[model samples]
Target: MKNKSGSFIEWLIPFCFILCAGWLIWHLPAFTLDWVPPDQSQADNLRGLHHRNDVTPGMSGPFGGEADWVDYLALLGLPIFLYIGIRTVRRAPMEFESWRPADRVSVFIGRVTMMMIILLTSVMLYEVLLRYVFEAPTLWANELSLWLAGFVFLCAGLYAMQQRSHIRIFLLYDICPRWMQRLFDTISTVLIVLFAFFLVYGGYGEALDKLWRWETFGTAFDPPIPATLKPTVLIIVSLVAIQAVVNLISDWNAEPVIHTAADDIDQDELEKIRAAVGAEGVGDLDVTRGSIQGNQTERN
Candidate 1:
């Protein structure tokens, strides 16, 4: 019963997003961020509700300068939509011999980013169809797609780390003894933590400022790109840091794996090829002369 309730809520969020997006597109004219005229202060209008100040007069207090209703729906929906996705998703480009809690979280976040790819493409497709088929194009589509793509790119680092797909030159570390390898790994993780901490430390202040001040990108749609994205940077960097720590812990007990040229090859893949061609010994005729002749003279 508990699991069922959680699943329902998870699916409900995306449904709400679809409804909100559809409603906004339908009632585009009724909504207007341009509450102020061009002759007046345009900056305040650009800041809109995202400002922490009384930019919109009576529209002040705690939720005063935040993004619009639809923007809120979009912001809230995307993460949950992705959260649902990673819950039952599979591995991506990288494979891991063992999975840790952090790896699981990163894998889930990675899948969420993958979901954003489809969503971003879909917005573009919607724009194309609307412009060509109906002779109308949306101004919001491009910005929406850009916003989604940003999250996809940022979250990808965490996904890569979780998958063990991030680039690493094993030249020196590979040849080290088991103890030395562990030491190297520890050193590497410490560096990552330090860097990650630095980012979070720097970005945290600005991110809070953005959220508190309700900053925005000041576009026509005026999505809270800065307001949302700033916090996301802190969150993403923190996740990366956590994953680094996770990697250090997970690999702590492992033996040093000495990589070779052969380690790169997928051995199971080679056997599949041999089996398909019925490959035997070196002189084995997996391909008959007749088959080759038939292949060469197919058009003849």
Candidate 2:
């Protein structure tokens, strides 16, 4: 039953993404064009120059002015995609060091970050090809890549926190008593939460204003980077704080762990390499297979 459910979700997510992507592509002309002026034939709006308010009546339909079946489908697919992203990551092996509900959320965001990175790369490559090979560079590609890159950076930070891979000096932590370790964890979590709080509190007004005005980048493409990213920064930071608290709670009773220089090594990755190269080949390469074996034996 578990495998069957996983198979279903695996198929469903891609199908839903394709549906959404197709919907976006179908509306690409509308999205890229300047909003049609009130008296103008919608034909003249293709310069893609205007802001949100200048969108044509036809284009405005998706934003609640009028209803379309495809628009509804796209809207419904998004939350389903988000749900599946969370669910799928929960069932997968941990690529990082931790596991929790918050970790699941962060991993899902990491998956999204991966997709955005791919999209950004594709856009840049497309622009390069167009500019160098076809001599017809696009105005929108650069702005769109920038927009995707920003989200990728934000999402990566959240994922890094969940993985416990963010920078830390554990020299003192390794020597501390378990109680002291818990105390240190609590202090760090509190500090993170407080920083997120002050950031949101101090910037809420300006973020809200930018969003309300639907601010856009001043480029010819004029993507809504400022409007969306300002609020997103606050949101992602808040999520990071929540994830920190979750990490603290999850690790509250975990056994005390000793840290050392060897802790920096990724045993899983080394094992993968050892498997690929075989025991004899690994020995020939002097790949520290013996040390890894010793560590595993000691842990057991």
Candidate 3:
């Protein structure tokens, strides 16, 4: 009981951290560090000889101060998110050995990738702050951040898949018998694995197009990063697909036991039994009287 209680506490700690991180990310855009106006004066200053008729674009518009400020904040906020993610993954209860071999690698990869994100976040912070704030903004920071985000997303997906912790509504599964639950598990696993495979295959062309075009944000935010994220996406998807296969096999051979319902007496009977057990505290006369009553009832 004590061991189970400790495990429960461990699980709750990470859950709470994730909840808070999500809240902060949701409100990040609403809280900006600087307020800049985008009126006519600001637009005139931003305008340069690059314009054909010397007419300035609207300040605080799409390419205006507000957008850049928000993006910069996002650049800052992403690190906090990455740090929380890393800590959560690192401190996650490690029962991976109990998992299937195929699934174990996915878990390992997910956790390590999380660590990499932390390191990458630090590098990105340096690049962005030094180049933009102190001196001048560099094209590298923008690309680097995007690349890191891509990996972070892909790794997170695999992690979720490995844990079998994805969003699922188990209303029907809750009441299902052991055999039926096993059937559903098998079917679900096959479907998910196939779906991931197709996604990998389909994403390849899009990835290639982005790579060929040497995509850039057409602003101060550009990087020479490769467009080979298709392979990364495919690999992560395949890992998840394999993890599903592992889960399917594990469920196949495992005992189909319901966790909550122990084969003890029902609640009412248990309460009666508790009362009878407590009756030992009464005087000997009461105990003798109860025994006599029980004897008479049995005889009847």
Candidate 4:
């Protein structure tokens, strides 16, 4: 019964997210067409939603309110979407090579970031199709894309740090002894923590103010990008710092790794290619099937 309940919840969360996303997209015409005059054809033709004339001052809902009651329900789903995002990441398979065991928090954020990318792409595609092909453009698509994109960038940074895939020059560190490597790692982690500390210290007040006021983009669509993104930047940077500390502790007594060009190669991708081309086709290439199979065995 416990397992069944758990499985049910697992399915329910994602289903809710899909429903929320679809609801928001469906209501975009109503939510963002506030600038349209009531007498205008566009205003009258928006699936019976009247023009929003009585503008509410300040954010009346979480991360800023939507156009009306219908829109507010979609906004209410944001927290649930965020929770499901975390759960998704925590449950993801750890397939990538990293210095430590997969950080569930970072992985969760990474999956959310991926979803944001897809959402961003869909928004852009929708905008492009409407503006060029259909002779109708949305006021909210650009702003919505920008909003999703900002979160994507911020979340990806934390994921990259957790995966140790962030930009770094290992030429000098590769030659260092294990103790020296540990020292280098410690110094780098300290620097990251300090950077995060000063950033939050300086921006906390401003971020808090914006979030409190729920600052909107001064545009037709009027998204709360500034309100949300400002606080998110500080939050994600702090997570990156914490993940760095975790990595340092996790790697303290680990084996010394030698950096090389081959380290950049993705074995899983190569395996896929080999599978697609078959043994005979792979033989035509430089890499041998024996070596590929050996790597797969070792990885498994």
- Best-fitting candidate, scored by TM-score: 2
Candidate topping lDDT: 2
lDDT of 1 by residue, 230-262 (tens): 888888988988988888888888777877788
Q: lDDT for every model? A: 0.63, 0.71, 0.55, 0.69
lDDT tens readout by residue for model 3, 183-230: 899889889888987887788777655543333344454332343455
lDDT of 4 by residue, 41-92 (tens): 5345442432332333333444332356646787679667756644543342
Model 2 spans > 4 angstroms off: 1-69, 91-94, 276-300
lDDT of 2 by residue, 1-300 (tens): 022223555545644654574454334334333233232444344223232333333444556423344555675787778677667754344365566667767876776676667778999999999999999999999988888788788989998888788999988998999999999999999999999999999999999777545567888888778877898899999999999998898899889988788877778788887777776765545557767887899999
Candidate 3, residue 128: Cα displacement in angstroms equals 5.6
Candidate structures ordered by lDDT, highest first: 2, 4, 1, 3
lDDT of 2 at 76: 76
Candidate 1 vs candidate 3: the lDDT winner is 1
Off by over 4 Å in 1: 1-94, 260-276, 280-300
The TM-score measured for candidate 4 stands at 0.68
Rank ordering of all candidates by TM-score, starting from the highest: 2, 4, 1, 3
Q: For every model shown, what is its TM-score relative to the native structure?
A: 0.65, 0.75, 0.49, 0.68
Residue 138 miss distance in model 2 (angstroms): 1.0
